[model samples]
Target: MAASKIPGWVTAELFEDLLKANVEGFSKVKSFKADSGSAAGENYATIMLRVNIEVELQGKSRGRSSRIKSDFPPLDGKSKPVSYMVKLPHQLEMFQEMMKRTNIFDIERTMYNQVVPEIEAIYEEVGVDITFGARSYDLKNAKTDYVALEDLGVKGFKNANRLEGFDQAHTERVLQKLAQWHAASAVRVTTKGSYTDILLDGLYKEENRPMMTEMMKGIGSNFVKSCPTYEGYEVFIDKVKALQPVLIDKMFDFAKVDPMEFNVLNHGDSWSNNIMFQYDAFGKIKEVYLVDYQLPKYGTVAQDLLYFLISSTKLEDKLSKFDYYIKVYHENLVEHLKILKYSKPIPSLRDIHLALFKYGFFGYTVATGVMAAVLLDPTDTASFENFVGDTEAGLAFQMQLFNSPRFRKHIQVIMPWLLNRGALDM
Candidate 1:
């Protein structure tokens, strides 16, 4: 796929309008350029802009090249750092159709516009500053659907290496943030009302389940075929095969929110790529931000926790600190819920552990499927298109990726871990 060209609607006027609204004493836009923001086969096309603007102060004007203490500088010859990551529909035909059918853009808009703002406000009322996502900009462009987000990269945030996964520090930081986020959303439900219809179900919505089913079948088939290639994994092959027929159903059950159970708005896609971390000068993570709300769903909090632990943490941390990590998450969650004066009965640590067992299949599926994508060799040819495609090349690519040494090693650990927990049981 080629770099996405700047949309026709992204003109000098748009940049000037944006700068003028945010920058004090804003004047005119000097220049701007758009470049591809993300890799190929990513769901949305992200285009970033290096915009140069002039803002007036005390009847004096300066360009972006001039250093200012604010988020944006005055108009100098040099362009300001890319401020916003612009999201547009995917360039691929198949992805475009799937995105439209799922209304991912619309759901994301609701998340940023309505849900996040409300959640943050709850935190502020309790004097805890929290940000779950990038600040969204309201831009009404009739030519195409787009989302303009405050670029976290400009704030020194970046994704951890997917292959390396998160260590104890990084994983704990993410869990802390997730707990607070979950706390705020839970309180928001009681304070405001239930979440909107758009956030009800994400990946496994009835309409999309057929597609997800096929994807799961592909992974399950390849996994079973490759099991013989690895020595001790033969024990898991039959168990995995038994799961193949019921895998999609179990996934659906885990994703769906049970009315009797505690629930929160889950960051439905919680893999490494969807999370960004900012580091201090010492290379320690200072802040972490969750991104890609295209799959936000209201479900058991266990969904996000299990997915992250299984798919994004290092194997040692995952194997050794699993319960400890869950305890950390619950501690923060209960703390914030009480601080917010949540009315409902607070869920106990036992409650969370029980939920983990109930949702263990969700974690297993992610370990087998999403972990491959996370540990994928960047040099290899892969994308969502070929990942789910039925073509010969697509099938070959899938098998090769599943059989990667990194993935094989990870799975060798994950399968036995899941079996011990009875996660393979249908």
Candidate 2:
């Protein structure tokens, strides 16, 4: 792509300065390449940039003419293949308006700038090594909003296939990281204080309720329309129609933390897309990182565990391993809380099981709406236009997602599981 197509805030001077700060012994940047970072339909809120740079060392001979260099580690100069993912606000008017209401960028900035650091510091004090996210850098253009992060791809961390979801190995790794992060956040709260100001009720906030309601109505109507095709699911049409008006309010209620419950900072959007896993040479999952903290909230841990289990894990493994997964998470949580010397009463496995049912409707919402999007056929071009635009094509695309075979198969299994567990109760 042309440099002109890149965000105006991303300049050669800015890149040189960023490299100097992040790279060891880095002096000057020669040239760079900028391109779109994310695939289509994966992300909608921000325009992602993948930037690769070739820089000169402190003592590099300033005699290079061509941009391409053959020297690996020459006497004075070394070629550095550095990459970064720069996120900029999407220019769409509707999305821009949504951002204004949601304050997603600001939330993410706080995650990188304050929340994660505070949580990581807790781990540091306890001498526990962990990484929750990519290293972020200070943006050059302080005026416009943007986030620049060290590319995890450079370190061999990649997202699992969203369509396939996570196997047991990958799923366990993500839960382990999440458990530690949650434990640290709990410690942070005990020592520092609650995170009430910024980590508000995430998509279910009162201010965004109207938008969410409208969106849910559209999804519910489409789902009801398609329920007739599924053999035993036709009974759900009226059930869903009855829920169309108050579903958003119900979800908001379910997301609320009960005074007696155990709460932590939830990775509000914990689908497969927001998680990255790194594998060892033997193809075994080694580490995982949770990304995209735009919607993180201070709430019951059930919110995250339910969302991830329902929306991201392999369908077959979901029901069978549900309790086992919860056990895994709670074990790690208890272990870390003890190590970090958390002063609060640690929640037991029974507490987690009870909380999951109490907040079970949140998982229902994920199964019906979010999971459809998650299981959408990648070959089908889904864009933000399909969500907000009033065009016929957009409407058709939206409906098509509900009718997807993969989604249909998942819903048949998950909806019953949720219904049997009283998640469908009003």
Best by TM-score: 2
Q: What is the lDDT for 175 in model 2? A: 87
State the lDDT of candidate 1 residue by residue for 71-154, as single tens digits: 554345433333567777646666666676587778888888888888899989988888887888776543666677887877
lDDT of each: 0.77, 0.79
Q: Compose the digit string of candidate 2's lDDT tens values, residues 101-170.
A: 7778888988988888888888999787888998878866545677888799988999999898888988
Clashing pairs in 1: 62-74, 62-75, 63-74, 63-75, 63-76, 64-74, 64-75, 64-76, 65-76
Candidate 2 segments whose C-alpha is farther than 4 A from its true place = 1-5, 60-77
Worst 10 residues of 1 by lDDT: 41-50
Q: For candidate 2, which ten residues in a row score worst on lDDT?
A: 66-75
Model 1 Cα shift for residue 246 (angstroms)? 2.5
TM-score of 1: 0.90
Candidate 1 — which residues are off by over 4 angstroms?
1-9, 40-82
Compute the lDDT for candidate 2: 0.79
Model 2 residue 89 distance off true place after TM-score fit, in angstroms: 1.8
Query: Model 2 reaches what TM-score against the true structure?
Result: 0.92
